[model samples]
Target: MTQRLRQCPRCGTLTPAGECCGAVLQRAKPWRMTKQLVRNLHIFAMSRKGLDAETYRLQLERVGVTTSKDLRRDAYMALMRNLRALPDSPRWKPRGKGRAVA
Candidate 1:
């Protein structure tokens, strides 16, 4: 495996792999924890409901967002909780083995 060396633009110091050099030029991860978690929850919900665009957009509207990228951490967590409760949702109550639409 080839080791990648990162050059710090601010101080010109070469940072070793997997170490922080306290430099501002380092590339940060694009995703926050909530962002990735929300994405996963959204996928789970989609598969659980087979929701169309209109229905999905309505769900997002309840959280005051057009996209998950705009969700706050609290909202992201709350959305995950709600999605995880799909089996208990009144609108789509489970009957026998499959979900029954109300």
Candidate 2:
């Protein structure tokens, strides 16, 4: 049987599938990092969902997306996109207000 080698996206090292290379390369390049930062900042500012910068940072850290500045930005953008998809108005009926009468 022939075994194929998989290249690690992080370290660029080739190893058998499901094996750890023990080294992580930088995920995002410098230029990409700058661009992503700008994009994420813009999205956060425009979002009406009231994104907190500190919370977003924490979330990014939890998700293992903090390998580089660009990765952080990408995570922020993803959050903004998710928030934008929700309905703008509340769907719940008020407790006091019953059905409207004709």
Candidate 3:
């Protein structure tokens, strides 16, 4: 197999195939890190629901993930953001009182 090496943009270190220098970059950008966290959370939720690989891909696609092989942090964030923006039903139970009740 041919070895593919690429220069890391931050440190200029040559990374071999199957490796990356994104960890440091991700740490530097809290928003990117948060997106990674949300992706992990989505994976965790999918696993908790006993979803298989195919089912997981389907769910990801439902949220605008075009390629299962290249799922991006932005896509995960968009999915979560859309989920959070969902409108609450008026018939739903009212939110509980705050610490004063507790």
Candidate 4:
């Protein structure tokens, strides 16, 4: 069998084909994945706990997601980096409007 070599864009190193080259080979963007996960999680949480969109948004904010575009960047990295945080149960909400709290 012959081995193939490919150049790694990260460190400008040549690595054997079919290798990870010590870098993450992301199939899709972290934000994209997190977005989808959030959507599904929202649906599930809503059905199980009566979480509305505003409530969900507030929950996300409490977990460090603070803005509409925040989820697309650093928040994405935060979610993707820590899988343990995903399964966490929703926290208690103080009595008030979600918008006012946000």
Ranked candidates, highest lDDT first: 1, 4, 3, 2
Q: How far does residue 17 in candidate 1 sit from its true spot (Å)?
A: 30
Alpha-carbon local distance difference test for all models: 0.60, 0.50, 0.51, 0.52
Worst 10 residues of 4 by lDDT: 93-102
Name model 4 segments beyond 4 Å from true.
1-31, 34-38, 67-102
Itemize residue pairs with steric clashes in candidate 3. Answer: none
> Which model is ahead, 2 or 3, in terms of TM-score?
3
Q: What are the models' TM-scores?
A: 0.44, 0.30, 0.31, 0.33
What digit string (tens of lDDT, one per residue) describes model 3 on residues 1-88? 9555655566767656334565332212222435556566554434334455675566668777744335466776665565445444
Q: What local lDDT score does residue 97 receive in model 2, on the 0 to 100 scale?
A: 64
lDDT score at residue 22, model 3, on the 0-100 scale: 54
Query: 54-84 in candidate 1: lDDT tens per residue?
Result: 8777777777788877777666677666656
lDDT of 4 by residue, 27-60 (tens): 3323344566666554445543555678767766
Give model 4's clash tally: 0
What TM value does model 3 have?
A: 0.31
Instruction: For each of the candidates, give the backbone clash count.
Output: 0, 0, 0, 0
Badly placed stretches (over 4 Å) of model 2 are 1-37, 72-102
Candidate with top TM-score is 1
